[model samples]
Each structure stands twice: as C-alpha cells, then as structure tokens.
Target: MSESTPSTGASSPLHVAVGILTQGGKVFITRRFPDSHQGGKWEFPGGKIEPGEDTLSALKRELREELGIEVQDARAYMQVRHAYQDRDVLLDVWRISRYQGTPHGREGQEAKWFACVELPQLEFPEADQPILRRLWLPPLYLISDSRRFGKDGFLAPLERALKAGARLVQLREPHMPLDEFEEYARLIAGLCHRHGAHLLLNAEPESVSRCNADGVHLNGKRLTQYSSRPLDDHFWVAASCHSAEELRQAERLGADFAVLSPVAPTSSHPGAATLGWEAFSRLCATANLPVYALGGMRVQDLARAHQAGAQGLAMVSQIWGANSIERAVTALASS
Candidate 1:
C-alpha cells in the first residue's frame, strides 16, 4: 500500500522510501490495499520515512515489514516529487539487486513478479510513470561519432555494439548536411529496428519523423529554442543539459530524459569545464527526470555515475574507440 499519510495540511511533501526489487529479469511488485492511498493500483513496495532515519534505513525497515525480505544489495536509483490534489510526495527510490529472502506480501497485499516488458500493462500511481521510463531505458546510451569514423565505417561498430547488447543508441552527426543526415538516419533507423534496438537522431526535431527514427536528441542550443515539447508523447525527446537550469527546462518541455555532459574532461573537449561527480550529484538531485552522465565516460565509470544519481552513462569514445566493441558492450550489459 502507498505510504502517503493523511494530509496534515503541511506544505512539505511526504517522503517515502520505495524499493524496486529485481531478479532474473523480472521485478517484484505488490498491489496496494483497496482501502489505502492510491488503492488497488500496482506499486513498487515501500513505506514512509520517519524522522531522524536515513533513506536506506527506512527502505530496509519498510521491505521487512511489508514484503518479508531483507535487502542485501541496493543502491539509490532516482528521486521523484509528485503532487496530487490533497498531498505531495517525494519518492526516494532504490534498486535492490540482491536480498536474503523471497518477497511475499506480509501486509496481506497481493504480490507478484513481472517481466519489465509487462509493466506497462499495469495501473500505477502517476508518480510511478517516471520510474517506469527509467526501467525501460538501457544502462548504456551509445552516441554515434560518425564524423570520426566516417559514415561508412560507423555501421560496422554500431552493428557490433547492437549484437553485443546495446539496446539504446543516438546517431549524433551534427555537422552533416540536412539532406545527407536524413538519408543516413533512415538507414541507421532501419538497422536499429532490425536488431531490436531503439535509435534517437541527434538532429532537428523534424528529422526524427522524416527519418523514421525513434526519437530526437536536442543539443543545448536546440533545447533552449523549444517553448514546448518538440514531439508528441509517442516519440522520445532527450536533451543535452549542462546545468540545473537546462534540466529544469527539459523537464518543463516534457522531455523523457536528458544527458548531462562533461562529467569529466574528454579528449574531444580537453579544455572545456567538467562537472565532476560531486556537482553532478547536486544537479541530479534537483532534476525531475532521469539523467545520463556523458563526456569522458567509459564502461568503468558506470558505478560512479550511478553513485552520483545518473540513470546511466552516455558514451562516445569509450564505445566507438574500444579495441573490442563486443567486450565493452558485454561488460556494460553485465554491469
């Protein structure tokens, strides 16, 4: 059941520690009791945080009390703040990969495991929508470096990456001519779909529809140009954000996610400023959407990225420059 307490008429949002427990490619979920808040809806299990307690402590206590499982391995996933008519909530979500006991509804709620693909079919509270999107996204976001590899040479590595388990890709060739880029995007889109991967074109918003790509990735300049979301909900809208303001704008524009870049100095932009892990975490804490850490990111940086509150890493050189694309991709998938 949702842990939202009755409205004390307080303006501060209620803080709930939610756990997403996964095993063998499926996630465990429970149905809220019909008499509880957000009743009868499916939800990741958790409860409210008491004063003077940390998030993980509250999470561990909630799961033990509500699901009869001891959290063994877990990490902060994302935070979501949502408002309903009577109350507001701040969901402190965590991803639990290991536990000591099997999960059961100790609270008399119905509990079950479902594959990630099946989650969309269930009804959930409005706040769970962003968490669902985060779950659907892959851990590694591969950004194309067509200019460095050349158009013809790019496909082989991309295909190799896909075969090795790269489910998400961004075709970013900003300098290419519009006509040429569109044509190339069409070919790439077809290839991505054939491999069961989704592709986002880092080109103009219109080009996504024209090229039949899965979505559009807006650069910082393009992000500022849009007063509203560039595409409808059917298409993914991702923006490259460097600061909190840009992240806020992306959220306001209804972007699905964002790539926060320059987490470290990159070879391509050695002189440019970097966010570093500390600053990145600060910015991510304020963001309402999932953020992927980009710039100078490699497979090895994924853990630190997650520690800093990133959904994952978006890579260019680390992927395209790897001596073994398959090995790099496989490592990312396993990570």
Candidate 2:
C-alpha cells in the first residue's frame, strides 16, 4: 500500500518495502484508508520499513502483519523515488510469487485481485506509475538487427518472435537512412500490431509518431541530447544506458524504461568494457526505471538477469542469429 501520510517525522525520505503478489496472472492490491496518504487510491500491498531492517525483512513483516501471509518467495523488482509537498518516499518493490496463507486485508481495507490490463483504469499513487509499467512489460526485449538480415529476411524471424509471445520489440537499424527507416518502421508497426505487440523505433523521437510506432528507443548519445522527455506520456520513451549517470538521466527525462548494456562480452563491441553481473546489479539497484540487460544476452540468461535486478533481457544476436527463429522464440518465451 502507499505510505501513510507522513507525520512531522524525520526529514529523510521514508523507505517503504512494497510487494506485488500475483497468482493466475492477477495481482493483489489494496485501497488506502480515506484519511491516509493517497487516500482512496489503489496500491500494491506493503508498508514502511523500520529502523535496522532490510527490505526483504521489512516486506515479510509487513505482509504478515497486514495480510496474514508469510512470503515464501520474492525477488527484487524495481525501486521508485517520489516526492510530495510534505515528504519524500523510496518504494522498494518486490515480486512475490510464492506465499503461505491466502491474502485478505487484515487492516480493514478494501482489497482485491486485478488482471494487469485492468490496472491502468484504477487510481494509484503517483509513485506507483512505474511499478504498473514494470508489471505490464514483457520479460524479453527483442532488438531488430535488420542490417545483418536485410528487410526481406527480417520479417520471417520477427513474425516468429511475435507469434511466440514476444510482445515488445525495438526496430534498431542505425545505418538505414531516416526516410528508409521510417518506411520500414511503419511496415513493422503494422505487423507488430497485428500480433498484439508493440514496436519501438530507434530513430528520432518525432519519427515514432510519424511511423505510427508505439514508442522510441534512444541510443546513449541521443539520450544525453534531450534535456527533457521528447515525447508525451502516451508514447513510451526508452533509453540505452551504460552507466549509472545515464540511468539517472533516463529517469530524470521520464523514460519508461532503459537497456543497460555489456553485462557480458559481445562480438559487436568486443573491446568495450563489460559491466558483468556484479556491476550490472550495482547499477540496477540505483536505477529508478525498469532496466533490461543487454549485450551478449541469450534466452538462458533471463533468470540470471532477473537475479541481477534486471527487469528482463534485451537481445540482438541471440534472437536474430538463431538457426531456428521459432525455437529461439519458444525458448525465450518459456524462460
């Protein structure tokens, strides 16, 4: 749940441990008391952390006290920092997949389960906006490599990925001329929408609307060029980041999410330094937006990426270079 209205308490930001409990594709949420902070709004279940307590410990205690459930399995999802007129808050969100005892609000609050699609219709605290996005976003991000596989060859693998449940994709053909890229993006957008998927163009932000794409994926250089978010909230704005500074910039620019790269060695940037899992995790811990691990990523690395605090894996070679596109897609979907 959203943090209670801050008392004239400490000047420091309140740290809250939030949990997103899911079962059968639905998430559990509770409404705050009318007099509480963000009153009458719906929020995922959780509470404030106490002194000397870590996030997981705080989450377990809060769930048991508020919902009578014992958290059995949970993982770091994402963190959000927000400020109100009177207070600042840090939401340490976790995905709780396994728990003991059915959840029912023990605190006399209205609680219920909601399908992910229904979440957008409900009112929630401002800080919860990113949390909702992370919940709805897919576990795999497919980056198009049309330069390696020409326009003719790209559609085949793309179709396979879409059919195999790849819901999010980035059309990243930097070498193509803008006009040509826009044309290709429109074609890809049509194909993506047909499969109930979203297509993000790696061209100029304005081209996203022109090509009828769902969003824009800015490269690191392009990301720093924007002082503010280029597009409105209706369009998803994503960025490619390699350092903590870029991540902070993405968040400051109101990006929906980001791709953090070089978690492992890659053929494309063989000489570039890699972040590795350790550094990747450290960077992710500080990011306010959901992050995807890129570079040398394969379907098998999905779990490892998750453990390292990445929302998912963003891959190019593993998906486009696979011998069997269908097999690769299947494996990634199942992972």
For each candidate in turn, the TM-score is 0.72, 0.75
Model 1 lDDT tens row, 102-129: 8999978999999987897999998887
RMSD of model 2 against the true structure: 4.5
Q: Candidate 1 — worst ten consecutive residues by lDDT sum? A: 1-10
Instruction: Give me the displacement of residue 208 in model 1, in angstroms.
Output: 2.2
Candidate 2 worst ten-residue window by lDDT: 1-10
Cα shift from native, residue 60, model 1 (Å) = 12
Clashes of 2: 1
Off by over 4 Å in 2: 1-19, 30-101, 105-110, 115-128
* lDDT, candidates in the order shown: 0.88, 0.88
**Predicted model with the maximum lDDT:** 1
Write out the backbone clash pairs for model 2. Answer: 1-46
